[model samples]
Target: MKLSQLLEYDPIIVQCHDNPDADAIASGYAIYEYFKEHSKNVRFVYSGRNAIQKSNLLLLINYLKIGDVLEHIEEWKDDEFEGLVVTVDCQYGAGNVTRIPAKYVAIIDHHQKEIENVELSEIVSGLGSCSTLVWRMLREEGFDLDDIKINTALYFGLYTDTNSLSEINNPFDKDMRDMIAYEKSVIIILRNSNFSLDELEIAGNAMKNYLYYPKNRFAVIKAKQCDPNILGLISDFLLQVAEVDEAIVYNEWPGGFKYSVRTCVKEVHADELASFIAEGIGSGGGHIEKAGGFIRRDLYEAKFKDLDTEEFFRTRIDEYFDTFEVIYASEYEADISKMELYAKKKIHQGFVIAKDILPIGTPVIVRTLEGDIETEVSDDLVFMIGIKGEVYTNHREKFERSYQMTDIEYLSDDELLKPEYLPTVHSRNDGSVIDLSKHAHVCISSGATQICACQIDKRVKIFTKWYTETYMAGKPGDYLAVRTDDPHDVYIVERDIFFRTYEKME
Candidate 1:
């Protein structure tokens, strides 16, 4: 999983998916550079029916002189590779990557898990690009990223993979964009050289004919097999129409279909819709306004059983809008007659004083598995770390009223604050990452007043009073609760968390 693990093998081969894009090349290049720097023999190569012919990719390679180390391998003299083979941006043995036999196989990918069971693998599907994964891995190993070529390649990889960063939502992806000191002029040239004349014609033809569903004010277009970024371009352009609030554009490729989703309406988040379209079959995620996904053809065939792809998309989109109910917490009133009163159980939690960590008025981003929360450090701003290691903000006044600080230390036991991914705080001004757990101290609830709550039967997107900009998603069986003291103060409690921390009041 870590870059250091691969150092055991010598003469390592770094391979990318066939028809390598900027992301694949960048990821492979980073790994190659890391191994090379460590004095390990490594060669970055890609094997497929076609070589890198895309104009933008060619420009990127030429500008960085990566072609010096990168090889377009077609034929192999040896029946099997002797050393370790590390597949980047694509899983080993997947339809997308050519199966190069090796003594040891490792996968570094940022796609839906298609090929599993490999011992050496690092795949985070939520990331916009594999480059971010490699960057993080290299940084963990203390690999130097000061080289201009590597930095620029990594930046372009993320830029192209996330559709010029418009679709990037993951905090890690954002961190890479922020941390990398890349060549802006080179990136501009590579971006401008993205579309070739043939691709431009394909986009033009694809846009001329589109399916518009008036009821939903959405458009879906199936473009000719082209670069995945072209799908984003088509969707973005289509969404500009007066009647269209959302656009879905997709294209079929070698092993699967790549699609892009765009939305301008707050009621519908593009990332949520993108995930909905690819549920169970693939992976999808990005920013609220723009997002994209990939659906494996094999998975699609197995599930849909010969269903038309377009028809399936139409049905899927309809289901997305029909399945969820939206709630604006400020206006909705809780019906206490039907809901039971539930009070917070006395549970040990953690808290961090804002002023203690950073100066007042200093901007900081709280990074969690769920997402990033932006808050400026202030004397009154208190950050509460939940029992699950999740965080919520509170004012000093409310912190004193709702909970009491304890002298106990934050526990490190099985039933306590052992999170899968530990939370961190990053100063936006200085780009410094702070391990949040280090600053946290234990606290206990004051047995806050009961709230009328009930389990939701359907999917809900509630814009809680605290977070008015973005809505919190709640699935069936999740609790929707309204504070008794202030009915307008509404929120959602995850099902497991609700059961773990709350008890019905007698």
Candidate 2:
């Protein structure tokens, strides 16, 4: 339903989810503004156990001028209030949201859950954030958000919900971000605010005790009781490891298992992985790179009394690896401290060492949809000899055996670097820098390819506009010459080397 139809009720009460986040609060505020402009009496209120605890939220509330308008649900006196209740960023009776007992007018939410007893409900599951839904409503009514604070608030809500716009999958979310010129300075500040001291401690402990499984190149951690947001933070931290392409961090809460999955590897999509892991046991879904969900442990146990819950999760993840198809799986000695230091160093450098460089003239194969093409190793660059005979080369990190090419094969001394191989043109087209950074770490639709470079083991560099001087890098599927957020920057690599490699794997 549109705002015009919802505004028919006077003195409408806007209910937000309990323990509201930026999306929840900003959504309620947007509705309040729309109704207030139309000369309707509306109050934005939320009911929850904790007040806004995140420091960034405190800053957002003050900077966006939303403090005075939002009210605690307890502040409302039933005798003095009379109007239909409208919920935003939450469903009427969802466990995470507060349910108001009164005449219900409407429900506007972005989550996949459904609710009952709502007359006017606008539930669009594809939206990255509920704020996007509210923004659409107000903008549709010919309302201009001339207020800088409101615009910033709306933008902040969407940015955080979508993980700095990294999680957005729909045009609606993208359009909402583009609707107004949001203050990037504020966003950078806000993005760093969600983590609390307690949460940081949890992350530190989780990382310290992390279980690094070499068999699958995964970092798994179990934390004490913590906020759902903390899981995301920890998962992001784990992905920084060079060996760990995917990170799965979770905690057991009162209800069930709350988990967050993150990946910088080109062959693993966190959203799909989460869904696959939670299948038949609980509910899970999210964006391609970043996603999360919960599994009702009680319900799962009821259905599978003979299975261990933790084992169930692990087995599912292994199944996903087999199905997704990756290049080669080599075992590594589990090294927690080494990974910790590597993860720490990458933040400063913006890149990490991808693989050991092979000696010059060492033979390696770059897998393609058509077939594997052979090439020589490079010390400082990734080289791909096209089937039609075009040679592609870039900075060393751009070439990873698991992500950029195929397995390393020994060639006799008589075999030369220039084997008589056909150089067919790569099927994938080139992309600008912005397109590259947006998909930098997510899994490719196809399996990863292991590209061989020099024989020396060294640190791999990752560069962006402000990062290292090098521009292009390799992703999972296929393609070369990717541009990032900086218009001037670009990453070049060969395509289809890893794409569909799983199907061709022996």
Candidate 3:
């Protein structure tokens, strides 16, 4: 829901999850500011067993001067008041948030859905932080982020929640990190004040006690109840050990488990392994080398029942390694005996000429849902947008030979390719972001290119000749494919997409 919708009620009150963190405080403060701008009687307050005590949080509150409205209310006054009470960074009546009585209640959160009875609520889970969600909502209402305090609060909220932005996975989080302007001095102060002596002891103790699986050279350490960011620090330090190739650090929270994964090996991407470990139980993602995840206690108990948490992690890691076969296309040959020959079907896709939008030699970072890729704008470089809205680099010669230009114009969100976020290129020269769709045109597959493809029953990781550092993961039912003309050129096709875009030849 839009922030303006809550303006209808007077004397509106903003609430955050109990024991408010940086994200919670920032989110509520933003709402309070939005209402204050509208001249609405708004009060931002939080209630819990204790008031804010964290050093960095106190610094954030003092620096932003939010102490005036953002307060700790032992008991909410204005009994039987007819106004709206909005919860930010948390859902109303959830395990983390304290429920306050009001005539109308609304929730703005970026956590798993829990309170469904609230009609006026906005909850988009899987975001890096609630601050990004609030920032996006404020932007929708045309709220200016020029206020350095607001910018810093939002940035710090993201920074703290996502472990200094090393655990950020969503595009919205990255966009906020790049586009938003904040006071560096204030951020530095808050960041340095993050760890207390007790937390330092917790980190040190966690390191001394760890479960090591010698086979995979991975270490799992459980820190005593501490800040989630502490888990990241522990994992980062754990990965520096010469024998440890990957590290998993965790700390228990009231609601669930907070875990961080760090990996120095290319065989297992930290983000991918984190996601695999939390697959059906919770949400997890980040960068290749560093990532984090949250496992809901309810979901964990429901699935594993009485299983030890350590064993669960160990088994998951083992499954992650055992189920997948890593294939380097450059050194591998395909056997067609068990594979079937398939021809490409005529399908309209999006394409962007590399030189059309940027200078021929401009260095750029292409950002997509898949990941960010570094390349330079060149005459021979072409970007091919697949049916799933994924963008990939293609050679101009191959693009001409394998596809035909189409008259159909490309739109960011088409019925065929309903992409979550359209691809964009950020120039390293001047730090400008260019939407690839602006210079995009449609193309039709030639239907002459053929591949020997076979559905895979096991997990596969294919490092094609192009991307040596990153491998595309293929799960069961996905196709392992090789170009008919070049048996060594291997790749994977997702189950649904493979069937939709290819047909077996007679």
Candidate 4:
């Protein structure tokens, strides 16, 4: 939708996320300016259990002159004032943001993951910062930027959200940075803003008591209680260690523990690690390089009862490595042609093939990402097969060089059956037939009534109806009788029948 279309709703309200940060405030303020310029009634609002508490965030709000413009959500009386609500920076109804009720709601955010119920949203992930998105929107609408305060706010929002432009990976973030002009001294001051006294003490103690895993270059620390931001700070500080490639810091709260993770290693994704730690315990996810999550205390206690928290975290890290191996090992690109063949019929493909059956003269297709080869089975082959049934003496060496047997999988007979294609029961009344041609031998239970066979003698048949008479193996009802021949060959094989036939011929 166009920018001007936002004014179609009366008394429009632009709302930022809970515990509003510089980015949220800046983005909401930008939207507020656009709607206000068009003479539409708009109010910038935020709602949370606590107001803006961080010193740097408070400073940014004052510096940007957003204190009067932004109001607490509780201050607005729904009965007195009602309009279309617009969520900025953070998505509406997300875990981080408090939900607000409105007749019609629109969302403008930069978070990658989104929830439903958003009818109008301009969400763009990987933009580094939501301020960049808002800045782009303001520019696209030809909004005047005579107010330097707005520019400074947007710049600060972009700077802090992307960690002083160090985390900016997209063109839009850089474009917004270059477009906005700001004083270098202000940026230096903002960057140098020190952590609180409590935060400093927490980080210091965490680093001093951290556990170092040299094999994976992972560092872990647990604290009794600390500010959530301190975990992130300590996690970053842990990466400064020469031997550390990844850092994890967690702190206990009422009924759960919040964790912050950071990784400089390209192969280790902090987001994935956070989720791994919280799997079956709690919720966790964030950026690739920096991520944080929470785990319920009950889950932690169940594993760490009568043990130290440090040892518990160490075990968790080991579990993470084990899970990582299993999850990441099979994440490589698959052969599209082999995948198509596997989908069409549950037979040999990329990693799966018939375990023991190598039908002579039948075409066998082996495929890998590099390419695929078609070969026909030959009778004389031993641990090697012909490309097209031709005798190749060096087949083993050639095949080994072309294919890695370790990567290919040989499947068993039980693995090839498609559940949907299998008959529920073998019966003529239901028009259902059981398939048995794939098996060399068949076993029938005494309780089984409806009988069907796919192979009769040396001929292959589709599900043909058959019958059998019950016979004891040893004693009465000792075991079910096994049939060797159904075409009366047993009588010919008897000694009496053979002797009588010979006598008649004589």
Candidate 5:
């Protein structure tokens, strides 16, 4: 139906966008008054609720007796608005109005065109404010605006929609002039619209975790579940941060995430970007410069489970720095090979050898630069060996109390020759003696010698002068033989465990 046909209907319902903002409310009221002058059955409706921060507008609305035209669907009479439904400031099925029936006759808005099938649609994308469009319509119809309440409503509609005239460029000066001529007190509106502490806290938390991606020319923030009004607050705050071209806020909601994307980049479309991110995951659509979307929690977790947030940002930053690579070539290419080599060597030599063997028991000895330190055999230290080594001794009782082959590894001769050994050596059970050739650094244990007695008892005397002569010949990674009186118990000690002399000979 045309505007003339829509005007012919009885009990017309004038609806605005869901959760009507100042522009939506003002434009809705302006149309409400226009229709009320010609008809008595007109009613106004909004899709969702408003916040307490909009108290000033609410007061103005109540004072102007606009509440008389307002009627929530739940409060509507069964025979209400059967003639026509005229939607202003929003289109039907645009996610802005809830439960709009198939009878919508006209839509007047300043947003991008939606609801292609409307009988009459007036979407002025060039207009800075939806209220301005309503003002134009009222003027074109020669409606006299003698009431201060109507002027005040139109003024707020223009001012708030333009973000107090901060959003429009200088080219829109005539529009600004027309808005200023209405003479709305901005200070009064702002002062009366102060947000509560809870609202302020919600905005503060959103800004704290803000992350910027210069390559994408966007900033992303995570906001707590909050009033939808806070989306505007976050966008405003992000615009003030230096160098940010676009701001996107993801707010956590029940089982899903809601996103509000805004940008000053005229060439970069926010709605396109929002749609791209929401594709195949959720739904989103809005004006070219500003858009919002929602993603379910399951979808987000599944897609980003492997993402490391810190590394993700670091990689983006690194990509940004890639653009200026030639400017810092020398600093970026400095060698780190020395540090890597040192780390590799340290890991190779730091090995542990268990003192007593048990399927899984305590009392393990870990050999490090400090010395052989005793510790318990636990799952924590099980990964310290290359392969398991076996130990054998004729004095089974002595071996049980004194030695465990739970772990072992090679060390440099200098590391193994330290006289400052641990004071907790176990007593040897066999009384034996060994002759050490100082020149050759050789130690040969025999059943008749004191080494045999030392094996039986824990206390043992080492002839260091002769032992070093025979054992201190080898380099860092060789093996040596440690013979026992029991031929079945003989095993070879790693050459790296011997002194430099023996290691070098091998």
Candidate 6:
């Protein structure tokens, strides 16, 4: 429904999502500005005060004089207030907000669908930020923009929600362009806001506490009493760490635990991971690259209390990494000799032979549809095999066996193997099939492939015919270059080499 239609009633209650983020706060303020301009009485209400990372958000609140609403609310006699209630940046009765009475008039948000009993609801995931939607509404209603406070709040909302415009895509192009054009000053304000040394210290400490599982290509970090906004900051930091495909941070709060998961690999979505982890436990949801969820503190502590603090967090973090395994569309065992011949001929011609052919200690490059990634050779990578002609490193044993390459499809520039599509490979030695798909692609450093082979799961056997004969001076566990499918690149082997190397050469 149109804002005009919804605002036909006077004295409205404007509420944002609980723990109001920048987008929610900005959207709330923008709506308040729109209504106040039309000479309507609106009071903004929220549950759970904002935290430290969102302190800059308060600047907008003060600048826009949203403090006036709080003042009016103080004067309001509970019985004296009678008006339609409208919620922005949140669904009616969502976990993010307190339960509103049946009097909810309208809802505006950028989240997925939720059970909201409001009379009017507009939830669009297409919008990059909820504030963008609010901005559009104000413009549509011809609200004045001369109010610096309103503009500042909206700008901060847009900046924080979109990660400084990093999350926006073509779908939000127009909205982003307009926001950028109109709110240039607001952007400057956000940049100048004091993020505070304490916040940075907390984030750094969280990183230091991260536990990495080489076999899974994932990491996890846990802490007590951290700002929710720091979750986003942590995710961004972990993505840049070498060899980390995905990372998660679980923060303990007074009443519950919140989890934030981030991925540089395209195959997995953060929201899906959050949902998977939250299943049969608490609540969680988010987008593909970034997602979050919450678990009641009592339940979380009860289930994980016996586990070592580091171990518990790491185990939970590794659970979802198994889903990223690389699986072939079909299974087959091609002759190793034929594959070797192809690689040898290609290598002789100065074409980087894209094959599973690095020795335990040979350094190699790993290239995927998204981009090139690198890691050092470790003990658990022996069972991973690249496609006959394809090269990449991973920890799982499922991708080792020969597989038939049928249809070839291209993924987006940033797309990687999704966890669901990974195929499991059975080991020929013990009649046991290991799922190697979990470690679909990897890079390894030079001179560490041999030591890496010893770390493979006991059930899988490693074949080494495809390894290069050259040996450089380095320890067995030293990093090595592993070949990948891309003809122009090589990757550092991060785990076991036996699985990644196919024997047919020596």
Candidates 1 and 4 compared: the better one by TM-score is 1
lDDT of 5: 0.50
Clashes of each: 0, 37, 0, 0, 52, 64
TM-score of each predicted structure versus truth: 0.83, 0.54, 0.78, 0.59, 0.53, 0.59
Relative to the true structure, candidate 4 has a C-alpha RMSD (angstroms) of 20.8
Candidate 1 lDDT, 171-198, residue by residue in tens = 6898999889989999888889978999
Cα error of candidate 2 at position 288, Å: 2.6
The model with the greater lDDT, 2 or 4, is 2
Q: In model 5, which range of ten residues has the least summed lDDT?
A: 450-459
lDDT for 175 (candidate 1): 92
- What is the alpha-carbon RMSD of candidate 5 to the true structure? 32.6
- Candidate 4 lDDT, 1-506, residue by residue in tens: 44666878978878887656678887888889888888887878887544665666667777767678778764444453367888898776664565667777888887655565676777765567788988888778788876777777788888877766899755567677876876667666655664666666767777788889887789898865754656776787788888988898987776677888898865566776787787777767667778777777788778666566667667777776654321111122222232111001111211112223455554443221111223444553323221111111223332333334432222233432222112111222222222312221211112211111111122111110110111101111111111121211111012221222122111
Best by TM-score: 1
Compared with the true structure, model 2 gives a TM-score of 0.54
Q: Rank the candidates by lDDT, best first.
A: 1, 3, 2, 4, 6, 5
Cα shift from native, residue 497, model 4 (Å): 64
Off by over 4 Å in 3: 1-24, 39-53, 65-148, 158-185, 253-256, 280-283, 286-289, 296-307, 412-415, 418-420
Candidate ordering by TM-score (highest first): 1, 3, 6, 4, 2, 5
* Candidate 1 segments whose C-alpha is farther than 4 A from its true place: 10-20, 39-53, 62-146, 161-185, 253-256, 296-308, 411-415
Looking at candidate 2, the ten consecutive residues that score lowest on lDDT are: 341-350
Give the Cα-based TM-score of candidate 6 against the true structure: 0.59
Residue lDDT tens for model 5, 8-118: 777677887655667787788888888888865887887554332355555656756766556545223354335667778778666546555634467888766656777
Candidate 4: what lDDT? 0.57
RMSD of 6: 15.8
lDDT for every model? 0.84, 0.59, 0.84, 0.57, 0.50, 0.54
Angstrom error of the Cα, residue 410, model 2: value is 59
Can you tell me which runs of candidate 4 are displaced by over 4 Å? Answer: 72-82, 223-227, 279-282, 295-315, 326-506
